[model samples]
Target: MDLLSDSALMLKVKSGDNHTLGLLYERYKKRLFGFFFQMCKDASLCEDLVQNVFIRVLKYKHTYTEESNFLSWIFKIARNVYYDHFKAAAKNKASDVDELYDLKSSDNVEKEMEQNEKMMLLKKAISKLPDDKKEIILLSKIKGLKHKEIGEVINCSEGNARTRVHRALNDLKDIYLTLEKR
Candidate 1:
């Protein structure tokens, strides 16, 4: 078989080729986990969310159309999974976004410490953003999704996705600068 694109694999999955789901999983597991980790900042929860997304894919497989973009479809499911998880849980117990920060490897201890501090500030800034802005930033900057794909995932027009992303980056910069002063 030729190297199948994500959409192709999903099409196979929709056609009852269950093994294709494994191929899709292998390709996207890390990306999906990273996406979830950025939001929840809990490894175990992110793992569960990833599983939920795939399970959703399976449960909703019949809804998949050949024209649908698989990545956008899966991410929509992920967004729903996140929403459901948060909705069911108490707010006080939500994952602490700060805990997601990790220090970069550096021979100089000072530089490593500085980098870690910066990362924490950035994560905190990102965490402070409103949910819509945060999701746009994650989908655009972190996941490298195009405006069209983001639009599909978020159910907005391409123009709206671009505008939201621009606004989100501006908001994030402002928040980050404010945090830096503290």
Candidate 2:
């Protein structure tokens, strides 16, 4: 029901109410996809990763606990899935033509093109970052998780999470500038 909290819904899922997971899936599917999209350049692979996260949630449903934050729990599983895929695909980096995220449009065509170019450069810069920093940036910026939530995802204190986000942003900016210069 609409009033059921995510934890309650997940508890239902853990209790063998298999259909309840679909509700969780609906609630989180887009955010999950967005997370994967920023982490990965391949659209199809991103889709697969989203499916894998749910598959993991279902496979490991018995472990769900009432005290656990459902969003953090699911993201931990998703992070693992991403790491597994990342290791497996480390040697085969390839890019596709599809835009990773949507670009805002304005009335001025020249500005739009310039903005598109800048975004592409930024994506390239993001790709150059180490995996952990990249994940932090995506979680903080793209996913809009607060420092405390990010700490939960990365298993650190909130202050540490804030520092990591700050460091990651600085690193990203450096990479973006270097790429832009070339």
TM-scores of the models, in the given order? 0.84, 0.82
Global Cα RMSD, each model: 2.8, 3.3
TM-score of 1: 0.84
Error of 1 at 182 (Å): 4.1
Residue-wise lDDT of candidate 2 within 117-162, one digit each (tens)? 8988887777678879988877887444789888888899999999
Candidate 1 differs from the real structure by a C-alpha RMSD in angstroms, to one decimal, of 2.8
CA deviation > 4 Å runs, candidate 1: 92-119, 142-144
Clashing pairs in 2: none
Identify the leading candidate in terms of lDDT. 1
Q: Judged by TM-score, which candidate is best?
A: 1
lDDT of 1 by residue, 1-182 (tens): 67889888898898999888998999899988998877767899899999999999999999999888888889889999998998888772544665445555677688777977788888888778887788788888645479999999999999999999999999999999999998
